[model samples]
Target: MKKTIAGIEIPDGVMAQAATAQIRGTESELIFHHSLRAFLFGALIGYRESLTFDAELLYVAAMFHNVGLNVKYHRSPYRFEVDSANAARDFLRRHVVIDRLIDEVWTAIALHTTPGIPEHMSPLVALISAGVQMDVRGARYDDFTAQQCDEIVQAYPRESGFKRKIIEAYARGMEHRPETTFGTVNADVLDRWDPNYRRLNFCGLVLGSDWPN
Candidate 1:
């Protein structure tokens, strides 16, 4: 029996099941619940916008979006977003999903942390970001009815101090590769948590570049 919340049913496809198993098994309880809520909230946003999208793909993307933050990939030099995207891409490829579809998921996960851009892309890309924004940033918290918010939370039950905990997760994931967080919102995590952290300045890089005009 598939579960339903906020008028959206969990995708019961084989791919979704495999993705769910992996996420639930490997991710911390906070992440696993957050992943579920991201999918639900994202689906609700899509429903509100009346945009057509593949829920299964969205589920898979949501499940893997924060995966790079896992301890296994913490040492990688790439951005956690790219690392997470790679995990989704590899999963999709192994399932014989087409290259085109894989790219959509990959791009969605890669750009989930980026604001102001995913909204202009495909529905899948846009909604994934919107969902993330809603869940983490409360981008449009009022857009959803109070009941919907209550329902989703009741279903997933966000742990205590989610904001701080999430920031800690991001900081831990990227502390070893601070360069990757240079120009993205992830840097905010380091700035807040890492007392010795120095942010990279884009203008400074520009002025100091070796290319002389």
Candidate 2:
């Protein structure tokens, strides 16, 4: 159940499972459940500040952040921390770009559940993780008026249905493979949806990737 998004191939079923686990349970959210959101937040930051970074890492991080949630909940709240870190380490070990930071990436995944544990990866990871925290806590932007925050919250449900569909597609083995090697399906699909649906969508296109018009 794999699909390529923005040149990075993802296992959609695993993520879907994570999301289902998150919605039905309560102990801690699965890393995979919120991955797209994290990636979107990271992309937003990247676009606004002109930061240069690898979209692959952002996508990977988002896709697998809560992998530990696949397991049933335990009495201890921190159990998923190590589980997620190990899963992320194993997953990222296959990639060359993030190979050097495998240890750091694991640390980020493990510590992401633990607030106050500073992020060990690059600043981009930190920023994106923060955005994720904001989302989980339902925090509103300090700068935005109360009304604006209300509007955003009302218009966009906290849950992400597009990601669910994407994951379902992946589970069904529906993939978007480009005939040309030059373009990524994620980037292409996102580009088409950006102008029309950017406001309502929280896929986090602006987080750490460029959205070319």
- On lDDT, the leading prediction is 1
lDDT of each: 0.92, 0.46
Candidate 1 Cα misplacement greater than 4 A, ranges? none
Estimate the overall C-alpha local distance difference test score of candidate 1: 0.92
Quick one: how many clashes does candidate 2 have? 16
RMSD, every candidate, angstroms: 0.8, 19.3
Candidate 2 CA-lDDT value: 0.46
TM-score per candidate, chains pooled: 0.98, 0.47
Model 2 residue 18 lDDT score: 49
Query: Largest TM-score belongs to which candidate?
Result: 1
